[model samples]
Target: MSFTLGLIINPFAGLGGSVALKGSDGADTVARALELGAQPRAQLRALTALEALKGLTFRLITWGGDMGELVAREAGFEPEVIGRQQGAVSTAGDTETAAMAMVEAGADLILFAGGDGTARNVCATLGTSCPVLGIPAGVKIHSGVYAITPGAAGEIAAMLIRGELVALDSGEVRDIDEEAFRAGQVRARYYGELLVPSEPRYVQHVKNGAREDEALVLDDIAADFEESMESGVRYIMGSGSTVAAIMDHLGIPNTLLGVDVIEDGELIASDCTARDLLTLTQGCAARIVITPIGGQGHLIGRGNQQLSPELLNRLGRSAFHVVATKTKLKLLAGRPLLIDSGDSAVDQALSGLVAVHTGYRDQVLYRIG
Candidate 1:
């Protein structure tokens, strides 16, 4: 029998990201994100993975409309439409229903696109009964079920369709309290596990939840950044606790999981969107301060999706300033920093050796890939 691949797309996933809403979990947040002009990219992300399967022979099944059918057709696949979405916008209940339908349809593997919330929904519907793979499309991707990038997820799914000997392992589904996350407090909870293809190179590891106890190290790094601030330059502060230290040093409120703009030692904007940054830094000297995810080592395309490619290209590679503690770099174990900006050319342009601020008056050369 031919392999049957089930597909699901959380259409609203990651919609709140570029708008700096932290996550697209609740209806209110999704509506607010739309009001803020946040564009939906989950369909595009799913299409990226589906396009990689061109000429591959497999039976595809998915939910109707933006959930999966539309993107599947765009990828030239005649997907068997299973269920119709409940309303104008699909809800978490729709996602759960789709998973159940896929399982009942005898799907060999399920491929889903979303963040940790989508992973949780699928896990709740069909635990370890079917092997699944995640295409990263959400803002809060603290879960271990997602691939490092959308294309990587496609490559792994292609492997399974070819009947290759792929190992299936349990990946944890984790979600954070968006309320706490927005308030600069991270509280992640373990929900459940799902059976997933074990491809360490492609699949992302769960984010490190342990708090950084090295307060003195953060102070030193923050001090180094504080010393480097120039007169007319706008600094784009990316998300993460490491970067938050600099904001703390400046006595400014940090968004914790959102982008902020600093200019002349003043908080110009907090929780900025991609469009907001573009407007603020247009025709102005600007620099970006970023830190890689602790366990994933992703410098972009993880949480800081607000750092869109256009802004990065406008600022150029020289405008990027990386900051991380030596311990964080050691955790990568020599893996080059990763970039999945959703633009291949941009990711290529940003790849090279760069100086990383390790501490006060300290730096080291590192590779960004």
Candidate 2:
């Protein structure tokens, strides 16, 4: 039995990441991102997944233009374009209509590329009628429907099309207020759920917020990090409450959801952009201190896009110091921490066992991929 795969690519997805707009949800934000020289990667990301399905016996169904057909063609698949796109720039309506058309066409799975907004739009149309998967091509992807990486999405899709056993589960579709997000407030709300393919190694878990009980652990980890801080050395602090605790302990103002830079116990830069970090790291000995995303165990690339792959490569693996509460690690249930820095070379280079600071004077070796 040949499986039918529906593809939807949000061309504007992840356009605001390196430029540091927090998200690309609205038309104005997308425009601004382009003005800042943000290039579309959704097509390339979708192509990465489709490359794995090159020889698979599956019928490709998608929309016209950059939504899906273009990417499918580029990836060597002659996709049957069903829905018609509006103008040059696609809108949320296009995503919704394409998804609904895919369902109507009896697609076995709907593979989409975008952030939470795209997920929400597709979920609104398909609901639980079809299984869905995301290619992780966005700035902020708190939705559980996304694969760990684009390659992983392809691998999982291949398994499904090859008649391999894969469990289906309800994946959460979440969206946050973009306005509030730009102002440093994270106000994420659950939109709904979509039936998604579940493969432990391929699919990502939903991001978990900080728990109240982790306060003491954070304090301990902060104290440990503070003690290890060297004078005259720059520290690039990645975003998260865990990293925020380090700044709080030093009485330095920090961006709770943005990357910051510190030098010799002084705030050099707050809420630094990727360009800012790249500029700061030139000829300076800098070390990165980051905490994994709760539940998902992602050390980089989820929320902290400011720490781009170039920055990570410049710093090398030795300059990284991973910190997490015991509770966060426990939530992984033996799953290794993940890293999707948008650079496969960097991702592979950083993969392996790394030490994670759990608490004061405590550490554990965890795998990073």
Candidate 3:
């Protein structure tokens, strides 16, 4: 049986990432991101998923222009335009209207391209009625409705359309206060929930806060890391509590939700941007220390865009040091650690087995791909 799929692309979703504004939450931020040379990838990200569903028997429903129609066409699917925007750019209201139209059109599933804000808009509109999946095209995607990667999103959607997967579950719609986020504070709140396809291997889980037990493990890992720190060497610390523990141990400030830099156990930069990282690491021997997101097993490309693929390649795999608690690793259940650095070559180069520091002088080898 053929299914009807709803597609919505938020053209300005991830505009603020590479430029380091933290999030593209409002019109002003999107405009500023463009001014700072940030290009929209929502359409390109949408295409990655749609390309995977090329031969699937489904009717595409979408909005006109950069919202969805254009991307669906670029992906070789003739989508029915069900809604229209008033001006050259689309807004949150446009997203709401499109989602509502998709529901009225009897869409079996809605596939949207955006981050947390877009997810919240769709949730506000559809609630628990229609199933939804997210293409990871935004800067901050704390929601659980998104697939692990855009390609994974397409694969899961295609399987559902082909009647290969039938189970569905309520995925949390979470968003952070971008204003507070930019000011170095994390204020994540539950927005609502959306019905999502339940495929643990494909769909990503919501990020969880650090636990009390994890804190002790982090301290041990920090002690090990500090002991191994070499003088005059730069360390680019990726965002996470595990990495934060290192900074805490040193009595230096750290960006809990943003990347930072240190040299000889001193803060060099706080809340560094991608460009800042590139400039700081130039002509310097640098190593990147990161921890995977809880439950998702993602070491890069989910929230830490400051560590761009170019930077990863420049540092090489040998320069990477991963730290995670045994509890976090157990959550993976032996699944390979994932990396979606937005560079296929880098992802391939960084794949394979790597050691993860779990405690002082204790480590475990894990595969990343």
Candidate 4:
């Protein structure tokens, strides 16, 4: 039996993150950015993952542009707008109103864009009864509920709808202190449970670095990270063997499989909860350096939960630094990086070419869907 699929597009998810926009939750900052020529594609960008649903038949409940309904139509799905569109709400209250309408419509799963703020709203409206997915469209998305990319979300949903056996799993729904988030100082706290499918493989678990007796050139990688420490940038280390090497440079031990946060060359927290990581980076304008989980090619939320929805907003989507050896990127051989942002909706938001850093002097463009 298929489920009733609901859709809501913030349409402004990551716009503020790059241009120093504070929030995309219908905030005035988003409006100001739009007035000053901020493009709306970031909102639409989150909708691309739905392209996978090209032939699927499920009832769609959604809001219009700024909500991303037009894009949904383009993806071959016509959705009913449950609320009166006010052009677009420029504040969090508007988002809540939209969510409330979707809930009232008896939508089963609400796939949405933006970071943790969006997640928090889903929690408020649907709680555990309604499962929600984040499309990783905003700057700082830290919760474990977002899909690493949009297509990945679609892939998982496709499997679920096809009756594939994916175990249902429940993960943390988290948020960061907004004021602290803006300053790069963060204090993340958990709100509640996010719906997960039974045996659901649609979402991915957090990833970590590989360790061997000799992790092959591990010292060299650590040395490179040591140099980065000297660069004195606040580093948001993603999961994987490459990032594990950075921990070696910091002289601090790491879990090697979870997200880590460090400031001014020292470890601020390891395997931190999204809330704690956000509090730590609240006011610090440090860059987040992450590597795709080797086989997974995820740059955002797979193994890096600290990039919670709220934190990602503060850091902005542009703050992401995807790192890998050229050899490893070849491992994917041009396959779009898989996303399991914990939320299928967020996964959809990250569906496009993104800039990833492979070395201090190297950056490669890659698709993340």
Candidate 5:
């Protein structure tokens, strides 16, 4: 028997991609992504994956406009958009309301495109009754509910609908204080539990093993981060212990569990503002030092919305520094590192082995999205 799925797209989710504006939630930044050829990023991944379901018969419920309705239609899901046409823009509050509607409407699985924050919003309302899946959009996805990649979300959901006896799992929904996280601080506290559906065919959840036991196998990659840092090469530490390894070696108190920016052993912007992040980058040239979210393999626009579009552009496509431990990379085995890119097209471009400096003026090609 087939199942029905609810899809919601946080229209403004992860719009910054590799741009420098901190995030894509603001009006100006949304316009900028469109101007810079990113209007389709949010829609394409879900659409293409849905459309690829050649013979599957499943129902979809979604929101109109920049949300999933428009993308679903293009993907041929023909979803029932939530609410009336309210001039084509939706707020975070509206997103929450729409999710409520989908849950009440009896969606078996609620799939959405966004980062950890969006997942939290849905979990707060729906809990575990309707399992939520993420399309890998937003800046930081600390939660365990999101698919490893956008296509993986659709592919897994389809498997479930096709009679795959999936197990139910509990996913983590972490909330980082954006204000505090940007201030070189991590006031991150757990919001609560999230519904994690386990269709072994869909996504797997393990956070690069946060202890010394799993870490022994990853010392080489951690070593790589340290050698690079000592060379005085700027480090844009992403939100994970892999990146934190460098900070540990430096003896600097890093955020440990949040995003922080450091230059020449000094914290320039800690838990900073989008404006402040821009200010921090203006005087000095910076390289975005980031590590993928273990199982997710994401490089940009996750858990760090402060790097809005304008600022992302300042960092540009080439200036990004993606660092991942060999153990984390092994999770994918042979798949190219995936990227939602916040914009589908760029996310597509994000595939393949790109150049990255590992350490000791030695560079290595790491596959990324």
Candidate 6:
């Protein structure tokens, strides 16, 4: 199992900051700032934070479109998208709605991007229900909830995901009156505090912040795949990142987006087609190593079209080795992994619970719908 990280990016959070508009709160100010050629940087700031989590495992949940989905995908994450924008332009309402949805989805933490206004919106919706970290992207970052820099926010999130000794404390969310600021007066109001992670370090006797380098779990999965190899038994390596990891561990060439043939830990053929698969596995003891598409959870179809119904029938379920990271599987949120082999009989036979290889000597029972 993996922890769920909720994400929300205020697409227009810092639009007015660069154009000397003070802040981007009202619609008129945003329009004026845009006319002055101010570019939006909130999404880019969020992307920077997400990139630090590369090779780590966590379930990502976010709102559809610019609120979070676009940046999440850009960071190589297949986040579970939820909620809808109620207006043409994303408003504070959207942020509040997204925060509420994150809580309902059982998010262990919510990582948001934007300024003090965005922080206020999230604070109003979530209170202290779950921990949150803020990326500094707005012009007036008076909020204590925000990290000093976007990179710091990402590093803190990576520490939390790695199970480091990080203390959770309440951080104040404060915002100033932009109008008063233009008149040479300062008026800051406290919205409330949110749970945030602070003081990241490692436990005793552990080195490097005690971070386990969870990325090595791929090596474990690959080891398990190698152990399953038999003498002269042909293995049809399928398309997907998980299988690619196995090939990497074996130190062999792999056509990442295509099928391959291997035997005795050596690559026999590269980029095999449907017809090629049937011909190669005929009259031979063969097995397949496959993985589901992240987020969609499609075990078959949706890219592996080469695995036709006839081919699946010939291979049978016993010949299949389903592999995936627990983080990827958990992102499906209990929804069954899908199998669309294009044959009703083949699909039915492939249905029901199946053991998914998650790591070395680790397996989880998941349904193939």
Largest TM-score belongs to which candidate? Answer: 2
Clashes of 3: 0
For all predicted structures, in order, the TM-scores are 0.96, 0.97, 0.94, 0.58, 0.65, 0.54
Model 1 CA lDDT for position 277: 93
User: Between the candidate structures 2 and 3, which one is better when assessed by lDDT?
Assistant: 2
Candidate 2 residue-wise lDDT, 296-352, digit = tens: 988888878788888999988899999988788889999988888777889999999
Best-fitting candidate, scored by lDDT: 1
Error of 3 at 189 (Å): 1.7
Models ranked on lDDT: 1, 2, 3, 6, 5, 4
lDDT of 1 by residue, 24-114 (tens): 9999999999999999999998998987799999999999999999999999999999898889989999999999999999999999999
Tens-place lDDT digits, model 3, residues 108-203: 999999999999999999998999999998888889999988888999889988888468999999999999988777799999999999988888
Name the regions of candidate 5 deviating beyond 4 angstroms: 21-40, 85-88, 200-369
The true-structure Cα RMSD of candidate 6 reads 18.5
- For 141-176, candidate 4 gives per-residue lDDT tens digits of 556676656665666666655656666556567666
Q: What does candidate 5's lDDT look like per residue over 1-369, in tens digits?
A: 447788888876666543333345556767885675543355665675575455788877787777776787777556676663355676667778888898888788888887666777787787777777777776556677877767778777777788777777888776556545435454545667667667544464534434444454345555665555543444556656666776676666776545567877777555444565677677566777666666655565455545555666666657677765455566756555554444445555545677654443445587664
TM-score of 1: 0.96
User: Which of 3 and 4 is the better model by TM-score?
Assistant: 3
Q: Model 6, residue 355: displacement in angstroms?
A: 62
Backbone clashes in each candidate structure, one number apiece? 0, 0, 0, 67, 37, 0
Which runs in model 2 stand beyond 4 Å of their true positions? none
Positional deviation of 3 in candidate 6, in angstroms?
Answer: 1.0
Residue pairs clashing, model 2:
none
Candidate 6 per-residue C-alpha lDDT over 266-312 given as tens digits, one digit per residue, 9 for 90 to 100:
89887765667778888999988899766556676433545656778
Ten residues in a row with the worst lDDT in model 1? 335-344
For model 1, the superposed segments whose C-alpha errors exceed 4 Å read none
The total of clashing pairs for model 6 equals 0
